[model samples]
Target chain A: MGRVSLAGVSKTYGDPGQTVTALTNVSFELADGEFCAILGHSGCGKTTLLNMVAGFETPSAGIIRVEDQPVSGPGWERTMVFQDYALFPWATVRQNVAFGLEMKKLPADARAAIVDHHLDLVELTGFADRYPDQLSGGMRQRVAIARALAVSPRVLLMDEPFGALDDQTRRYMQEELVRIWRREPKTVMLVTHSIDEAILLADKIVVLSSRPGRIKQVLSVDLERPRDEDSPDYLALKRYLRGLIHAETAA
Target chain B: MSGAAAGTAVPVILPARRANWYRRLKPLVLLAGLVVLWQLVCLLWLPRLDRQIAILLPSPVQLASTAGKLIATGELPHHLADSLRREAVAFALALWAVPLGIAMGWWRGIHQQFYPVVEILRPIPPLAWIPLSILWFGLGDVQNEFIIFLGMVFPILLNTLEGVRQVDRNLIRAARSLGAGEAVLLRRVVLKAALPQIVTGLRVGLGFGWMALVAAELVGANSGLGFLINDARSLLRTDIVVVGMLAIGVAGLTIDFALRGLARWLLPWSQQQGGR
Candidate 1:
């Protein structure tokens, strides 16, 4: 029931004369509880695609639906975890997580309970009172994820959620993400430039071409849970994805 | 003696508490040095000058004695109260102007309508409006207050506008995606984000208000620190004038310090990041 379908979605910026095409005829469907990754180069319009789905930006031409209902604007049903971990700097971790619940006008006790639960889910229980600046980058992103999940959104949109972390932290966060997602399954769409990240986390990888982005390929990741990166199958898939992205970028 | 020699071999470590005490006293020490230097100037340079010039530049002791006299007569407090009352009125008025600025900053239509007028008037010093204020409100507290309002309002208005405008776009989007409507977004995200800048504007505006209050009093008001200085100048009481000037400086510093404390208390998160 949490299916997200984007059909012939296109987005253009600026006026017609100086127009920049960001995406072209992008079409895809995210099934209920499916973990999908949108892999692309820097200017591949992957973020634009994510923004459209999140209802932050409207597509110039397209129909986007979630659970057979069209998305007109941003709603709690489609929550986002931003790349920069846009946890409000002015707010404490608990307050940031509680924001959505507060907006929903939940009772004070109920809001607190949900915030506490999500903070626990993100393992930020003890640090809930701390401001975003006081935490490390990885911890801040975990707070951001906790904030997003607090709303109990049907679709969780993550745009390069681990892009800001160091390699070690990034890998660690990927494992944490999978563990969290497995615990509370939802329709997830993660956008990333890292092929290894896409292969490691996503059930299905949708590779996007550069500039006026279009889906170049959709590869199903049939790898087992807690997949070993050192295994031949994982290495083979990583090589294939790397080659695809490299070829598209080189072109 | 062998035990003493062994103890001397170890490195001496400064206690953290003593270091903190030194840090705290540094500013006071520097201030005392400044006073000493001023006294030296009065003794060495002023005494050598003509009597008239010497009278014009009173010694720090002379200034302090004059302040003591003013305080004894309760004249200083009376004049300060009058000036502070005018400042309070001006500040209250400036508070009303902040929302207008926020509206102008937030909405394109409102900004286009009001921002040009603000831009045009912003460059003109508040003192420049003194003549018009006198004509409009007559030589009274109203005239002084009008000038003070002019001085305080712009900084508050401009800073608030900038603060609202500069609210991170991503934060707004995040709020929207979190099911916040426009009203909730403005109240929770935009206003909270802009608070640090707004507090900055308030602190800056308060200093400007004090400046304008003095200027207004100098021109038209019957009482205030500025009037006290002006009256002292006419009476050739350079000491009283110096006292008034010192009062104004100290008062401004106190007010600024209080506002900084208020900002810290109000926005504790900003305090952690050392504010905007």
Candidate 2:
């Protein structure tokens, strides 16, 4: 069975006059240990769908299930990395990463160990005591990644996690994400607009149409993990993904 | 190595320690200069103290003598205690007002329902309510406390409401995603996000409260800095009035400095906003 599955989901926001249909009958399943990407335009209910699995929002229509159980409330088994990093500015990197474990009621030693372990994984061990303000954007995002991974969630939902970083930093983050995924494979659902990014990370690229987003197409990457962006195959795949987006817009 | 790099300079001293000392002393030196000019003006033009001439605004020498005698007589401590009590009571009462304001502010329906009434209550000045407070609680500590509470609560409530409203909607969504229920959301996310602004509000409110406390005390209270100056007015003790005035300024300045330090310690994240 899939680790994270969405079935016939729809979400409408607000009252009749100002109502916004954010998602319409969207369905997908993330296979265990696969890195899946949800690619769509900015307004395309992509984040909303992710919010459902994160248990931030319940589907207005259908249902979403995590590990074959109906997603009732936000579970510790699934963690989300927001686009803006959302690192508590008042907290040190270690404290921010320790938040989930602390919520889980882990003993201090165990929680500290897990926080240290993830910080090491993200190559931020030296920055544990440093506050988010003291760190650069890239470093902050790395700390955020560590914070999410520290919880050891079964399914990781990344919503434009590297969207705020510069190009070089974004590339570095993507590579690091792939490396982390290899170290400990969990069902990963990443939402992004960059076709190159989706191609680089996703085992399957799930494309959505514009507004009131629905699954327009799902394309298998066919390329291997830790894929090279400079390679001809990766570029070709990116062009194909871009073409799909253009086609959707044109229609 | 000894030669000056610049064309005009014979020797490069790296601007002497004397220059650094001068730079540090500049503001105090400027203040001293202003004092001398005022003294000179007073010496040349003003004849005597009739309270009519603006130039007769008590000389530093006169103020020191007045201040010294007031302290020697133990009136300073008595007045200071009275002022401190009013401030302490008002501050405690203001704390109670914040959660009440938050309840009204956080919930949309509550805000709508209470906003009109709150707005109506807010416009009436704390000073205007002095007569009623005196009538209701009589001329004592209770009346003084009531007036201070009235003075501070409006600004505190307005500030708290603004802080709650200003909290990022995204943070709320993020908290909900983390399994933060209503209680957790209020305690963890909402309160944390709103704190810096609330502190600012509290600071402003406390300042107004102090001013109102003095005003309230001046009317009928037997003790306090305000009462000290006021009673001195009838006795024609200008020295005590001057001492009382200076004491209020110094005390207010000290409390404001302490509050700024508290804001820094409490909201470390606030400084990192990076102009955004």
Candidate 3:
């Protein structure tokens, strides 16, 4: 189980005398196996918060704990899917998926097995031998997802994983992500700016105010799976969250 | 639908055969034109203008005949073999320099310690060390090899350092997030990312190395293309000198072509992506 808790997490950059705060007095808790989405405007420190949770950055003023242990540096338990789909262009899709497993010093056969499973999970079994440059934008992102999942991380942190994709591909990937998340239940923290995306996929949505980011609200999503956009309940929640985000960004 | 149907569904395709033929023959045509121009200037035009110029610069026919005589006596082949041997040794030494370059690029301390020394030494041309090389190795292949080594090492070293420094920060961060430690990060990500640039460095270094080879051999070598040219100059056999110059140019071109092929084979992804 991967339960992450951030208490009064504040990140300030530059010297203390002349500093710029990115996140201020931010607190959130993601329960085990819960899919949480941090929704905020650009420069609202959503990525900084996610990076802190991923242990890529340290919080200036608060404690971030994952499964009761203080976060240190990047660990295998918290794999990230970056927005740019950072698949190694030199490695084939199969090899890219196997990267984390190899880092963990798994045997060749086991590594191959896990890589094949993840590739198949992403429906990219046929393109196993192709490099990232040979794949389309969506295909590369799927490869990134497969690579991240191949290690069986305790928590998956995705930083706007589908932001670079077109609308059609983005919608398709959102569905694919949910389907995959259900099949392999792990605590997931997705950072995104899209209100509909947050409402559609997240079990809980945390909205933050712009600049020197502070938590504005945390709304628990109680809608059923495969929530319809046209449904009154889904639209209502989307409108409410959009209003909240719009207000924060506008202010 | 009717209006669209009236327009041609498929664009007319132009036959690429003529264009392909022209592209294929372009270099040879240009080279032949250059030779014709040279023959016209030296054999026909220059002698009319100044008889002494014709005596100094051999025409294409004279050069060809001289090359034929050398080939028949196997002298050209022997000299070429010696020169190639020296080149191979220098190139091998240059290959050894790559690891040090990689270390310097990867570690900040190493870069700090060695980079200033490299910067100070790099601007001084390799040929400037010819006298020192002669004093040390004393009129042998080792002296020529030293000059070539000096010429080749910097391009490989600097290019490798730049390649490592230019590796995408996001790629490293992504690898770290996937549990890669320092060694794994260097081996799997940094090395692979830097490879295309390294290959480019090797190619550039080899070109400089070949240029230095002639300079090195000119000073004190007994059996190389440079020596061939120097000997012909002393003997007043301008045709043989021209032949030696041609041989060096052709050999350099051939080796550069081979290295390019190697780069293409080693980095298929870079080729596909149209990376240099």
Candidate 4:
């Protein structure tokens, strides 16, 4: 139910006479229950592409469809985890996780259960009473993820969700996310610049070139679960992806 | 390891506690010194130099006696209650600015329509409206309230506008993606995010409104601290005049203190408001 398809998407900003193109005639498909990473350098419009799917922005020319329905405005069916972990500062962790359920007008009893379940899922069960400011960066992002997943959306969009965390925390969170995905599968599109991250988590990797981004390569990861970074195949794929990105940057 | 760390921490905390104690005492000590100097000048120094000038500046002991008589007679409390009531009604009336400001901040067309009008009116002092207010409401509670409202509404409205405009864009997007509609988003997200700033606006507006209320009462009312001050001045009761002025100062400080406490309670997540 969560398959997403993009057909010839392009985005342009500013007036017609003086315009800046961010994405150019890009197209790709994400199969249901698959984890795909859109890997690119900064300012590469990877985030813009993700935003269009999340319905925060519209493509100037092209179509994006989720579950065979044309993408429209933001809805509960498609949720996102932001890099900044935009949890409401005033709301407690439990309340933040329960936000979507509340929006859906779920009964209090049902909402509480779902909130507890998701907070437990994100391993923030003991921190439900804390405000966003009281938590560390990694804990706040966990709250964001828990908040997004509590709604049980069909498609999950993460825009560099762990980019703000330290290297150790980021690696730890990657494994935690993998563990969660294995237990409860959902369509996920992760946009990031980290190659190891993409290789470790994604079922498919779509690499885009720099500014005015267009898909340069779409490689499927045939590796087994919990792929080792030092493994020969993992190293080889990382090397190959690095070469592709370096060529684009050099050019 | 823990024992040594605690031992080192003890010395640091001792100095910090002493510094905090000094900080708290410094202001009160200075205020006490100033009061003693005022008593000295009025009772011991000024009377020798000029008896008339000494009579004009009442000594602390003289002011205390005047204040005690006013309190026993209930005159001071009556005036205070009237002034506070006028301020309360006008401040409550001015709260309509919050929603209007949200509209202006959220919608470009509304902002374009209302901004110029606000800018034109905002710079005009509340005291400037006293004459017109008296003409319209004819020297009663309504006249005083109108002046206070004029003083309050602009600050509340402008701060609310700034607050709404400065709401983090990502919070709105997150709420939307979580299935919150426009109205829901405004009520649940935007309003909560802007609350600390709104409270700040309320504080500033209350101060302005209190000052405006006193000014309005001076010109066109019969029963307020301002009226009492003016009445005392007419009768050459300098002690009562000083009492009325001190009442106004204490009342203003109390109002601001209460609003700050309310803001802290309402917004526990906001450390910036507490810092102010």
Candidate 5:
């Protein structure tokens, strides 16, 4: 019964003067424990669609629901890890990890246990006392992951969380994320422009079209855990996703 | 090994305890050299020994003796305490001005309502405000505080406004993405992000504030370094004036150093920002 659905969702900006459509009549279903990746070009509404699910933005039309509850606004039941690795710069890693727990108004002793658990989950246990800037790009993203997971939300929303990292770090993080995603299995909706990442991480890949984005296709990967990138099958799928994304970009 | 090469290399492989002091010492030694040359010139230019002291300079020995005696008597402490008291009042006034100014700046409506009045009053110099403040607040701490506040507020207000505006858009997006409600976003994310800038504004504000307080004290205060300098001028005691001037410079340097240390301690992330 734990599934999120969007029916005829649309988003438009501006008043009566000049209206701009970002998303139009978009509909999709994400079942429990599904890892779905939305991929698109820069100006495309991949992020906007992800924001809708994160409750940062509202669909101007149609219904969006998680477990049959209408999407109203951002709530703790859904957690998001942003691209910028937004750990509070003033806060130590442990404090940043503890913030959502604090906001949920959980008592301190219980909150500490939850925070420590996720910190360990992300393998950031020893670096808990360090500030965000002290950690490398990949480490900070792990801290953000720890923070999001600490709240134990219904679903996890990620918006290109590795976008700022170097290519090597980005690849390494994708592997770590797949491992974490399997163990900590929450339904995750990730927005990315990287075809390689989408192929690597997603159980179901939802391809988004260019600006004024609409879903073009959803390809489900029937592959196993830690799918070999060097495998011909994985390479073939990567090439196919890359071609579609490239065709969209060229257009 | 050549004596000079070995001596220089041995001492300078790493910089001195004060890194820039080695560079500054050359100029300082040059300055001392010039003073010696001046004294020698005065010996040639003037008639006698006593006349030479009057025409060119109080010899270093004389100034040192005066400094020694000033320290020995309770006079230095009395004047120092008075100066510190005025400085404390000024800094406090500056602190009050900053938060009020920042609050005004953050809310656009308050900024619009008050900015014009502040701008109109701002151009009138603190020296000019000296007379009016004395008249309105009477002849003591209040006048000094008012003068300092007037001097401090504008910089703090302008810088604070800039800080608020300069907050990274991505950080805000990140906060919102993480399901941060409005109050948490503003209080935790916005304010903390703006803090290094706010500390910078406070430093600049307090520097100007201290100068304003000294000017205000010159108007009616009977104690304080400003008064000490004025009294010395009236009594034709240049040595005391020298003491007062040196006191003010040293105290200002000390306070600024302390403020910088506080900034470093409080905002460790500032070090990373600077490195970038």
Candidate 6:
């Protein structure tokens, strides 16, 4: 189950007189435990699409469903990792991870165990007591990922989760993310402007047109794990995707 | 080699220790210098100007003796306790502003409804409320507290409102996505995020409340530092008035120092927030 499906989704902002369409008739489906990346230019409403799926925003038209149930609002079943790593500043890493479990009214012992496990999963077990301010950006994002995973959400939404990091940290975190996903698969939808990131992580990459984002192409990534960017096939795919985005941007 | 290492260590450590000691004593040294200058003026300049003016402005020594007598007679302590009690009660009562402010900040309708009323009332100084407070409470601690409350509530309320308004929207969304209900989000995320600003509001509010309390006591009460100052002025005991003034300054400084300590303890993560 746990298939996320969007049918003819459209989102418009502002009043009827001067409406700005953020998304227009976008339709896609994420299969159970599938890793899907929505690649688009900045301000293409990729984040808006992710928010709609995560139930932070509602589409003006069309429906989004997961497991045959219509998505309502933010729920425990879906958790998100933000680019800003929105860990509660007042909370320690452990407490941030336990927040979802606490909301579920889980027993203290169970919550603690889950928190420990997730912290270990993110390789931040040594920093469980530290506040978010004490952490590097990468470490903070790891805590956020741990927090999202501690809930064992059916759907994991990441909004350009590594976009803010330096290049080295970004590459390291991308690998870390893949390793974690391989260990514990979830229906992951990562929105990013980085074509390399999309190719490296996603099973399927859905490219979108510029503002008033529409699904332009949905290409399956048939490459093996640890995708080699220098390989002929990988380079060819990158060139093709870049050409597609360049055409949209130039237009 | 060991002796050379020790010699090098002494040179490195001695300067740092000396610098820290100097830093610690710098303010006190300046304060002492000012006091000496005041005493010198009292001895040489004020008396030469006029004996009557010298009597009106008591020297530090004269003020100290007056203060000693008041303390020995328990008069100073009694007045201090009375003023502190009024301030404490008023501050406690004013704490209701926190929740009310959060409500106003969080909900648009509530903010729109209450903000205008607050703006209209806030501009009227707490001392301005004294005549009405005395009429309502009949010249007592309640009257003094009412005035202090008026002085305190607005700073706290407005600061809390701003704090809540400025909370990171992403934090609220993160909490919601984690299954935090509205109440849970407000209590856990919103309140914690706003605490630094709330502490700042408390500090400013207490200062205003203390000043208002003194003013109210001067007008309508029989005991307190303000009353003592007024009484001394009426009796021409300028030494007692100066001592009372000193007590007010010292007490306000102590309250602010304690609040700074509290803020440091409460927000170890937010070391840079809220200027002294």
Relative to the unseen true structure, what is the C-alpha lDDT of residue B78 in candidate 2, on a scale of 0 to 100?
Answer: 80
Compose the digit string of candidate 6's lDDT tens values, residues A89-143: 9888899999999999999999999998998899999999999999999999999
lDDT of 2 by residue, A1-251 (tens): 33878899999999978989999999888788888999999999999988888887888999898889898767667778888887766678988888777767789999988988899899998988998888998898888778777778888889999999999999988999999888978889999998989988889889999787989998889886668778889989888888889998888
DockQ of each: 0.76, 0.35, 0.61, 0.70, 0.33, 0.74
Task: Output the chain A TM-score of model 4.
Answer: 0.99
Tens digit of per-residue lDDT, candidate 5, span B26-60: 66897899878755655555446566356334444
Candidate 3 clash pair list: none
Q: Which stretches of candidate 4 lie over 4 Å from their true place?
A: B1-26
Best by TM-score: 6
Q: Is candidate 5 or candidate 6 better by DockQ?
A: 6
Span of ten consecutive residues with least summed lDDT in model 5 chain B: B52-61
Which candidate achieves the best lDDT against the true structure? Answer: 4
Share of the reference A-B contacts seen in candidate 1 = 0.84
- How well is each residue in B92-111 modelled by candidate 3, as lDDT tens digits? 99997678888998899999
Instruction: For residues A109-181, write the lDDT of model 4, one tens digit per residue.
Output: 9999999999889899999999999999999999999999999999999999999999999989999999988
**lDDT, each prediction:** 0.91, 0.83, 0.91, 0.94, 0.80, 0.93
Q: Write the candidate numbers in order of decreasing TM-score.
A: 6, 4, 1, 3, 2, 5
For residues A99-158, what per-residue lDDT tens digits would candidate 3 score against the true structure? 999899999999999998898899999999998999999999999999999999989999
Candidate 2: tens digits of C-alpha lDDT, residues B143-171: 99989888888888888889889887756
Among all windows of 10 consecutive residues in model 4 chain B, the one with the lowest summed lDDT is: B267-276
Could you give the interface RMSD of each candidate, to one decimal?
0.8, 2.2, 0.9, 0.6, 2.3, 0.8
Task: Give the Å error, residue B270, model 5.
Answer: 3.2
Q: Runs in model 1 with CA error above 4 Å? A: B1-23, B27-30, B40-45, B272-276
Tens-digit lDDT track of model 4 for B94-135:
999999999999999999999999999999999998888778
lDDT of 5 by residue, A30-97 (tens): 99989999888886788888788877788889888999999887777788888987678889999888
Per-model TM values vs. the true structure? 0.94, 0.91, 0.92, 0.94, 0.86, 0.95
Candidate 1 C-alpha lDDT tens digits along B1-276: 687876775445436656879889988997899899989888888778766688878888878888998999999999999998999999998997778877887899999999889989999999999988889989989999999999999999999999999998889999999999988888888888988888889988999999999999998989999999999899999899989998999988888888888888888887642343
Instruction: State in Å the error of residue B175, model 5.
Output: 4.8
Steric clash pairs (candidate 1): none
